[model samples]
Target: MNELSDNEALMMESLARGIAVRAMKDHGAVPPTVLIGNENTVIEYASEALADAAAKDRLAQIARLLATANDATVVTTILESWARIAKVPGGPMTERIEAVMIMTEHRLGSRALLLKIERTEHGKFRRLTPVSVPGLDSVQGRFTGLIPPRSPSPEEIKQARTVLGLLGLSPDGKTIRHDLN
Candidate 1:
């Protein structure tokens, strides 16, 4: 992956915060005061600030977005597009974003993984390791440690299942595996 310039990196952080804030507003969430903080600050702080202020419906919307994604690469690409549109750097995808992607992957397989994203450095994040569910493990463990725990609503799961099926994926035992893989 290409390394982003300092200015470009800051722009990406700002863009992410802007996206989060928009999501909040679109979902009727009363955004947290911290959202108005420095845009170049840590991404985790921005994500948490938006998350804290997000109404249950807003959170559900965000959760559903994460849940329906097919994989981390696709999720990363979606995130990259935002940065690309702003003509900013978007390398070394943030852990918080990765957390949402990985969480969605596991949740689609019916695993309840919970995680919290915390700020570390600017444009960076750290997530709490999710507790493993006994007898329920991902078949494609390609992104084990990167995943955060989160359970999707039944409706979200249904939608995700439809998406996965379209992508040629299906749950086998405790894991969701692609048929062609």
Candidate 2:
């Protein structure tokens, strides 16, 4: 796989995040999801395999599948996960932080984005903050060809904003508050 343009990488990341947010809204939790694309995207929900596979095994299976499928140049997997992270910049690590993990293997290599989130006492997920990790990019696509992508639809943006509202975020965050008050 060749490196992606800066714009292409950003677009892929945004789309993957939107898909995860929407899944959270639908399932009340992030289920393992896989999206494959060449010129079109096909979404596969891995909920059935969740019972049979551990997180590590599941990811490996996805990698193997992608590698064998010659046409699949991009693959993204999203799931609910726990992350151990520092509560302060250089302070004690939090034992467990609920998170959304999105891993993508694409034209420009790979990235796994972990967005830290919290479930309020009332059981609503709040906040979507990016966290840095050293080795999360372990899922590089071994694609021999780059998959050309179709243009993003306008509706995709609207749908993402809706998911953000569902997750209690504002667009710029002031005028579009997600609070019910």
Clash statistics: count for each candidate? 4, 0
Residue-by-residue lDDT tens digits, candidate 2, 1-181: 4445444455666877887677666756776665655444443434333554465464444433432342455666676777787666666776677888777665566667888775569887665677776566664542212233433345644554455455443332223445568
lDDT score at residue 180, model 1, on the 0-100 scale: 75
What digit string (tens of lDDT, one per residue) describes model 1 on residues 1-181? 1223334333433444445435433542212211111123221211223333334334333323333332211111011111111112343433332222112122123222322233357534333333233332332332222222344457755676565455343421022455675
Candidate 2 backbone clash number? 0
Per-prediction TM-score, please?
Answer: 0.20, 0.59
Q: What is the C-alpha lDDT of each candidate?
A: 0.30, 0.56
Model 2 CA lDDT for position 80: 71
Global Cα lDDT for candidate 2: 0.56
TM-score of 2: 0.59
Instruction: Give candidate 2's error at residue 29 in angstroms.
Output: 0.3
- Ten-residue region with minimum lDDT total, candidate 1: 75-84
Per-residue error at 14 for model 1, in Å?
Answer: 1.3
User: Model 2, residue 101: displacement in angstroms?
Assistant: 0.8
